[model samples]
Target: MSWREEHRSNLELKMGKVVRLLGECEQQLIDETDPPTKSRLKSQISELKGQMRDCQGDLDSFGQEQVTQRNLALTMASVTYEDINFVITALLNQRMISIDGQDNFQPTNPEEKMYKNDLTHNIKFFLDMGLAKAGEVRHFVENNAKINFPDVPERLKASLNTEYIKLIRSGMRGDELFMHLYKFSSHNNPDPLRQAAGLAVLCYFFETCDVFEP
Candidate 1:
């Protein structure tokens, strides 16, 4: 097993022990009539539950770290959409993002709060790579949406638009909305490259086609 998987296994085992201990403490408190002893047991149970929560959080972070590693691997590609995503998110985060559309000139009309501060880490995470070759992945995506990778724009919009709007209307924060969008597009696919592509598609749509107004 990978070290992360093994570490998660160990955490699971530790969590199991904490749960059993918590159960025992609760049972002891139920049976013990002594007030001070019951208070001590209550405190112990609370601590055990906190340990369980921390362990679960560690386990969750480990899973996300695996995705981070996978995306890091994708950065080695000659042309990377992550760079495109970085540019768009960084511009939005800075309140200076603008996009000229066919006629209306979208100007990336996002709610100020949706972009400022919300995408700092989102931009930082991709910038952390600093390995993405300077390329016009965004321009490529825009130009070829109907020619080279014809399916991408249509398919991405068809797959994501309605839910993207729903998520925005639901008042979900930007980063959280992106996570849900990523999972929706990725669909738990196990392939790393596909995951990267899925993320690129989502980020691209975020810039051009989706509703970020709420």
Candidate 2:
């Protein structure tokens, strides 16, 4: 399932549970006429209401902050090193990049190499998965971006460019800027392939747009 869908499902599940508990509390509070018992039930009901509010707040944040990708969280879990390596090889074959003996992208400049070298595996990891799904992941990413960015490719490029400019102005070096972009894209996710997917998408944009310079 897509990450967005899964996240929504979890939030909905929590909301449902909170609502059910709230109903049970209200019913018990109404049935208990004893002053002390009623007071306890009221306290319990209040807590449940607070929990319900918290759940609602989380749902709202999910709606607002998690704007865009419906990433294939489950699909990413099964990727292997060999699969990523093959994708890297394919990229090299396509003349998208040149590889060294260690199979890392050999960019022309030291700065470019420093920026992309550390995340070589991660970039390849998502590339393999994206193409394997017949570009399903890639298509959804663009589709999702279209919600706020009507210009499709150009809007996407502008968004990344803004971030790149901000990072540069903030005194971040090439390597640091690259890492910032990766983490920003991944939402600092702990999942390996998911994080890799973030880098892969960034790499895609870099190729198709002018986000970074050599």
Candidate 3:
């Protein structure tokens, strides 16, 4: 959707029109000598105000839907460990940040917080390796998988390569990066291949698939 064509604009237009209509109706009511004429104008003004409220509700719902769509789209992307690490570091390095909303980056203690901070610095090293390079993310993701789960299936590795390629192009934020990580960590069945995709990410991040924190 074009930015100008969004629901907010429609609401503003509706509000402005309603305000003008209400002002005219109120003025007419004040001028009318007949009680019945005044009652009709008062009813017209109330109807216009009700329509404005409905328009405002629609705008609020549309804004919420946009946020939901963006979240779901990013989740479906299911970023690799490399992408997650890259984004977290970007925030620590004072690059990208949340222009709105809260970032829950608290660590349990000073040491854990320091460790999280260090992870952010390490990401800068990865960033210096040319984050925009086509094969860079793929190489880092595949290498992470190889180091953590040497027995990862070939088909899963290939799918990861494709997803990393897409992730590099989209430019997700730090929190968004981790949110997708959670989405990527879900497995559907006993098929080791499908399960391995999720396991590789958990193992890479938390040192083991079973020990990983949500």
lDDT of 2 by residue, 3-85 (tens): 98677667555554554455456546646789999998889878876775565566666654322211332333233343333
Model 2 TM-score, 2 decimals? 0.35
Q: Please provide, for model 1 over 9-41, each residue's C-alpha lDDT reduced to its tens digit, 9 standing for 90 to 100.
A: 566556545644654575466579999998999
Give the deviation of candidate 2 from the true structure as CA RMSD.
Answer: 19.7
Query: What local lDDT does model 3 show for residue 83?
Result: 44
Model 1 lDDT, full chain set: 0.49
Give candidate 2 regions above 4 Å deviation: 1-138, 141-150
Residue ranges of candidate 1 with Cα displaced over 4 Å = 1-117, 120-123, 126-155, 209-214
* Pick by TM-score: 2 or 3, better one: 2
TM-score of each: 0.40, 0.35, 0.27
Measured with C-alpha atoms, the lDDT of residue 145 in candidate 3 is 63
Q: lDDT at 14 for candidate 1?
A: 64
Rate residue 52 of model 1 by lDDT. Answer: 63
Provide the lowest-lDDT 10-residue window in model 2.
95-104
Error of 1 at 189 (Å): 1.4
* lDDT score, candidate 3: 0.39
